[model samples]
Target: MAIKDTSETVDNKLEDKELDKTDLASVTNGAILGRDLTPEEDRRILRKANLHLLPIMAFAYLFQFLDKTALSYTAILGLREDLHLKGEEYGWASAIYYFGYLVATYPIAGVLLVRFPIAKVIAITMFIWGAILMFTALCRNAKDLLTTRFFLGMAETAIAPGLSMIVAMWYKRSEQPLRQGAWFLGNTSAGILGGLVSYGFGHLHLLWGFDDSCFHHGSNLSPRHVRDDRFLTKDGRAQAVARVETNMTGIKNDKWKREQVMEALCDPNAWLLAVAYLASIIPNNGLLTGLGFSVLKTLLINILPSVFQLVFVLISVIGSTYLPNTRLLFMALNVVVSIVGAVMVREVDPVHKWTRVMGCALGVAFTANFPMTMAMVSSNFAGFTKKTTVSAMVFIAYCAGNIIGPHLFFPSEAPGYKSGFLAVMICLAISAVLCIVLRFYLILENKKRDDAGDAIEVPLEGINLSDKTDREIPQFRYIY
Candidate 1:
């Protein structure tokens, strides 16, 4: 198909009748301007673009999750016994992984994602971390395992946030929740895959198997090789490029604006979201890895939660796609369920082991809000640097929570970590409240934007390729 001449197509529309910023709010949710996108044309470009984007993203993320969670799998597969891990050393090992991620993500995103193509950067990191995963096989002691895990964490740190920026680059704000759900599904997929892999370790030793390390070939998914722009005729390239330009997201804006960073820092919503994220992760991060090893201590039971979570993830994605503004609603609801699950896991009597196990499964279903939050980050934030900065901050919180999470479950707690459960319950309660607060705050902000008359006295012509901050752009509307 030929590239749709968005410039010419839009020129006539702009000249005939311009869309005011009031309509820009509609545009923020993926409305088309004039007749620039016929129904058929819109579907065609979107199908083509998503066809190009989703598969690689899912595959890369699958391995990223699998590689990270492989450490957890190793727990059931004899890692602790093999490494002679006593008490808090395993906790330290778990915590150190995110510690590496915490320190690495900021500089990597600031320097690398801003400068080079994100696909290249993702590829480089995937390979490096895969090598690190392979290196994990060589660790003979707890110290060696800790070192390897830390570097592996560092290698994988930028991936989720970087991919968030990439999805924003390609898809509109409205479609992001669905697309983000599609990619983030990889985490669930990894959980399932890790379960199966751990099962393999239980039955047939999977160590050093050629295919065991899916990371070796995960890097082969270079965008050039997959969604090759070269294969697209000149017209197609123009259409694709115009879509990005229209989206007001440039592929590369070399200069990092200080004001954008400052705006992100000043944005209270960013902090609220970050804190909510941190709270949500603490219950689920470190303890999640040990659930199977601790409770049932059986390989099949360990893998079962992932299966249930995969179902939950799919259900949440479909719910978001159909329901529109109910993302936060589902988030709060999921956390409430998770809190019930936490209590069950902590307090179930010996006769009700199965009930407790079911509760544990339900509690970890809090993955619902993550895709929503990532989509929120992309939809709400404008300006490349500001968005990136916010993305970085979110990951910083993610890293911190994951890092601190393991420590909450002390070795003293053994099979039932009461303190850990209580801590998670409190954080999750806080997160649930924050979810409502964030939703209300955005609703108020949107109402105020409507009152302000959503018209930019002077809007930019095509795209804000200059990377203007959302605060600088009065016409911009933040999406909930």
Candidate 2:
């Protein structure tokens, strides 16, 4: 006879004054049948959400990556000459985009996502970014390019964190790695697809025009297609919310908690993850292009690395899903592979260009580390505000690294940016070490909880979805 919330209770809790605004209304109201889901029922619901959610997520993310990297592609195809860019102007243009991204991530996440529906915010931002990308086509000088790139960065910043939040909302911890990686393959797809598109346009001497059009068109496509509500019946929506209850991380919470912001800022684990992100992203800043290689060879060289990264990301995420407690371990291993790849790029004789290209492909192994870390945040962090804050901080680190990363490729270095490659190798090593440290820290924290008799497993109904931080929940165990 116990009352519970499910399909019948949808929107009923919105009028309850006693209920915390931070609680998801569909979850806290009481009106539906009370029962635990069977294993088969759980799988059915998961599959449905995956089908409806992931494709749109992946497609949106693919366009985001392409839009962000369009400048780099155009640079190789005469953007520098056409814009009259000089010395470090090109690097500044690249770095300035991230400056807008860094400036916008925290405030935008804190304000817009909390006040508006997440899907709506994402959709609107997508439209804005698409318009901004179209504007990139009209940039006739370095100042114009810099101005357009900055606004584009601000517009696009919402997508990555927004997508991460969506993954946490719909999926469980066990499902997060693969789902996160699946969407992130947008980055890999952009690389491969962008290279092919750029290669085709390069032959026609129309690379910049096509890059702008592709970015704009791709951005505009995602807003109308996100059918999140239509994916499931009313009953299926309840089941989707119910299945993730054991996560103890509530779906969507509008009310911000100042204490949770401080918690996220002070958490040692958050900083560790931030450092890992910072080190890993520095290497992603620049790629060798158009140093005298034919457009065909340049296309091959650009695409080969993305293909290799695609393979490595798939293997790593799948391995994380099937293997127990191997998420951080695999992340560290990929970073090591990247280190070896960086060394190969730096030390290999220039005459052996293909060998260096192979190294470049291997250098991207660390790409998998990012989704792994995002999964860790989704699995480990509780409370919507805290989780969002942590995500913003990590991305700020990401933006900072990207900003600093391009400048490391000194214009004087020309074909072989030895200094830049060396920096890449060092940062990759640091990231690998930090991943190991984080794993140990999580292990120790879990052990302490177990010793304190606070690690008891709870049923789905027994778990608190009241927007508590992981630290406040003694039963919460940190997952590596």
Candidate 3:
């Protein structure tokens, strides 16, 4: 726990022939070295980190969600008509975004995020996407819309992986779920904001276009203008690094390890998490529902699900922090709720409108599970390369699910979209089962590590802060 004592521990291990010199040499030179913080100082550092970091991330995430789902709101305001969208062209437009997302996730996450300064990379991507959002206003046809959305998808891919890594860098393993949920609230709450924005600007033609173009332009530029070290002092940065030492997940490491990438590809937990993500996102795409009502009623109705999602996400993630080893448990429960909601939406009579509206609200409850899975990635993965690689794999599955989601909503099905709803039920069920499977897998892994008599104390001696993957760190424990 003492940074000064860490050198003595390293020296003793070296003299005892217990520590490899290569491991010492491979540690990043940028690693923050400092004294152990007081409990009060730890809390103070956390508060400062949260205040400075979370708001910027949350704001950027809000705009990202808003711009991405703008097509949904705009479709209601005649985006289809404006672009002269044909039968399945609108669905293709929605699906195409993920095609770009799927294409770009690997290089950006596995390479770009690793090779560059994290904050600067995030800022540049946000600015590029914001400009793409502006160009969206100028699109005269479906082709232009698809082109812009593709690049927009590519640009916006940085936020989730980057922010998750930031959380992993700054927060403790126990603190990650709440922090991840906090920023992700931007995504859920964007529904309410998008509703209000669409309602206010729907009737106005040029103003709506201008708002989309200029608002994003202004918001995205703010990050680049801000200094990177504005919040933390020199000593505070070291304490911040010291804070997450027990996490067993190292911070930034510029040198990419090919073996780590291969390990990530072979990791059962990574594939399990990826499958859960794939299942959840397929249903997420079909959650938006509307009745044939006035704009005000439609706005109010649409806002209901966002409200539902917000409440559920808060309850689940906040609850995870207090309850030990229940992150995946809560995730499964969220998916179960969505399955029940999907059933209600599919089975309830069309005449029972309010009931179906409530069903629609419940149908999206599973959105809460996403942040938990992200929390798993942040808390569970160790090596920076493996973490980013696993994240890219999971997001690739996410993109694939999203790409397939819209196409499931056959135009012939119209308002019912029975096939899409059916797919939602199936995917939700699969996701719930996978959550339980992942939980059990982690439990078994932890048991094996314990039974093998790994040196749980070695991690305390500074080994945890090394650029070693979880597989190489026998002392590392998985958080379920």
What C-alpha lDDT values do all the predictions have? 0.69, 0.76, 0.77
What is the TM-score (0 to 1) of candidate 2?
0.90
Model 2: lowest-lDDT 10 consecutive positions: 219-228
Cα lDDT tens digits for candidate 1, 97-173: 88888888877875677656667778777767867777788788988988988898899876787778777866776
Better of 2 and 3 by lDDT: 3
Query: Model 1 segments beyond 4 Å from truth?
Result: 1-35, 202-221, 224-231, 243-251, 286-297, 454-456
lDDT agreement of model 3 with the native: 0.77
Error of 2 at 338 (Å): 0.4
Backbone clashes, each candidate: 2, 0, 0
Q: Which lDDT value does model 1 have at 194?
A: 66
Q: What are the per-residue Cα lDDT tens digits for candidate 2 across 458-479? A: 3334243456778877777787
Between the candidate structures 1 and 2, which one is better when assessed by lDDT? 2
How many residue pairs in model 2 have overlapping backbones?
A: 0
lDDT of 1 at 245: 47
RMSD of each: 5.6, 3.8, 3.9
Candidate that scores best on lDDT: 3
